[model samples]
Target: MATSAPLLGKAAHSKASIFYGADEYLEELKKRYAHDHEIAALKNALPGEGDPNAAGVAQSNDKMLSVQKNNENRSLKTNRLFPTPNKPDPMPQNLAFLFTKITPEQMIYMWNVLTAIFCSQVLMVIGYCAALATFPDYWWTCTLCFGVPFSYIAIQNIYIDHDVMHGATFPVYEWQRFLTHPFADFFSLPWEEFVLEHNRHHASTVDLLIQGEFGWDPEEFHYALQQWAGPWSSNWYKYLLTVPFIPVIHFFGLNDTGSLFALEWWMHFPDEGAGGKCNKEFWSKWIPRRIKHNAFVLSLWACIWLLGTYPLGRPLSEGWRFMFTVSFFARIGYSAAWMFITNFTHSF
Candidate 1:
C-alpha cells in the first residue's frame, strides 16, 4: 500500500504539469485573438466616433495603409520611369535596298569621285573668271565657259541631294553631315522640305494622284498657265510654252512661291471663313526668316562673282550681267535635259 501511494502521487504530479502547459498555450492564443479583434473594431469604427484608444489604433492602421499604398505607387512609377531601347528597323528587300550595301571599297570610290567632281568645278570656275578678266570683250565665250561647268556642277549636286533625300548617302557618313546637309541646303531645296516631299512621294506608291512635285495634279500648273498666257489664250499654245518651262521654274525655286499664299490662308482661315485674313505674326516671323535664308545664299554667290571680276578690272555691272546670263542659260539647259529624260514618252 505504501509503494502504491508513492506511484499514484507521481502520476498526479505529471497530470498537473500537463494541465499547466495546456493552460499557458490557451492564454497565448486568447491574447492573439484579442489583438486581432481590436484591430478589426478599429477599422470598422466611424471617424471621430470611436474610443480614444481605439481611435489611436485606427489612426496608426490608416497610416500603415497609406504607407503601403505609397510604396506600391512608387514601385509602379519606378517600373515605368525608363523605357526599353528600341530595335532598329530591319533592311527591306527591294530595288531601293541596293543603296544600303556600302563596302569599304565602294565608300573609297565615292570619296574619290566627290573629290574629283569638286576639283573640276573649282578649276572650271577659275578658268571662267580668268577668261572674263583677260578678255572682257569676249563675253559669249566667257558665258559658255562658266555656264557649262556651273550647270554641270549644279545638276550633279542636285543628283547628290536626291540621293541624300533617299538615304542612299550622307546618312551613312556621319562625319560628312555638315557638308552634305546644311551646306547643300543653300544650293538646293531646304533639307527639311526636300525630305518631307520625297518621303511623301515614296509613301504614295498606290496613291500617285496626290499633289507633289512629280505628281500629275494640274491645279498649280493651270493656275500658272492662266497667269502667264492670259486667261483667254489657246490651251494648245499655253501647253506648248508652259510645259517646257516647268522644270526651269522648279529649279529656280519659283514653284514654291505660291505656297506662301496657301500658308497664309491656312494659318488664318483654317476653318474656312471669309473674315479670316493673313496672320501678321506669321508674316512677321516665318516669311522674313525664309527670305533671309534665300537672300544670304544669293548674296554669297554675288560676292564670289563680284570679287572674281573685280580682280580683273571688270565693272560691277558687267559682273552682274555675267552672273545672271550664265545662271539663266544653265537653268534652261538643266530643265530641257530633265524634261526630255523623264517625260520622253509619258503624256504628262
Candidate 2:
C-alpha cells in the first residue's frame, strides 16, 4: 500500500475553512458588512490562502468575530467559525541521528577505537592461555574446562561480529567488507540481509498488517500461543523471559525463512534481469551463495579448532582454544547488548 503524505500548513488551513464555512458564506457576508472595512482589512492581510500568513489572518479574524457585536440581528450568526492556531508541518522521522551525520574523521576515530578493543581482546586471551599452559600440570583441571572456550566466545562472538556488522571492526577497504560480511552466516545472521530487512522495518514500524512477520513481534507470537494453549497458558512473564532464545532460534534456522518478502528480494538482488533467468536465478543463486558462506564459515572454524587442538611451536593448543572461546562469548555479549538497545529505542 502507498503511504499518505503529511498535509501541509496551507492545505490544512483551507480544508478547515471549507469545513467550517469560512469563505463566501452567509455568516461571513454579515461579518463582511457588520463593519464595512473589516473584510477589506482581512483581504489585504490575506492576499490568498496560499500566502504564508493567510492561515494566521483567518484564525485571528475568526476569534475577533466572536466578540464584535452586530445588534441588528440575532445574538450571533446561525453558523460560527471555530478558531484554531496555525501549526507548521511536522518534520520527517530521523533514523540515523546519532551517528550517520558524524564526520568521516570521527567515524575513522570510532573505527580505531573498535579496532583497539578487538586487538586487546585477542591479546588478553593469548596472555591468559599462555599463563595456563605454563602451569598446565597444576592448573590443568581448572583451565581445560572453562578458560579456553570462554575466551574464544568473547573475541569471535562479541567484538569481531560486532565490528563486521557495524562495518567498523575491519579496514575500510573493499576487500575487508567482502571478507568480513560473509562471516555473518556463522556467528550471527547475514548482516547485508539483516540491514535490508531492517530498512523495511523502519519504513513500516507499527503498520500492524505488515510489522510482525520477521520475528519483530514477540507479543503477537505469545498471544497466538496463548489462544491455542488456553487459560492454562503461561503468563507473559513465563512467555517473555524466553526472548534471549530468539537468536538461537534464528541460528538453528527456525525463524530462518523470516519474512518471505525479504527473502524474495534476496533471491533477486538488484532484482532486475530477463524473465526466465530472473525467476530461476533466484534459487539457483541463493542456494550456492548460502553454501559458499557455510563453506567459508566451516573452514574458518576448522582452522580455529585445529590451531586450538594442535601445538603450534611455542603456542600451546590451550592458548588457541582460549582465544577462540573468548571471541565467541564476547560476540554473544555484544549481540545481546546491541539487540536490547535497538528494541528499546525503536519499539518505543
Q: Every model's Cα RMSD, please?
A: 31.6, 21.9
Which ranges of candidate 2 are over 4 A from the true structure?
1-100, 137-171, 178-191, 206-244, 247-296, 312-331, 338-348
Q: What are the per-model numbers of colliding residue pairs?
A: 0, 27
Model 1, C-alpha of 338: deviation from truth (Å): 4.8
Q: Give a tens-digit lDDT track for model 1, residues 33-75.
A: 2443323232222222222222323332321111111333222
Instruction: Give lDDT: candidate 2, residue 112.
Output: 41
**Candidate 1, position 148, lDDT:** 71
Candidate 2, 1-348: lDDT as tens digits: 001212111122343452322122223333422332322232322212321211233322332111222444221322222222343335334633432322323333443444445445445445545555566665555444444554344334444434433332223332222243222224322333443333333222233332332223322332233233333345546535565554553333222222233244454343344553443444654455455555655665455445454433334445455445644444444444434433333332
Local error of candidate 2 at 321, Å? 7.4
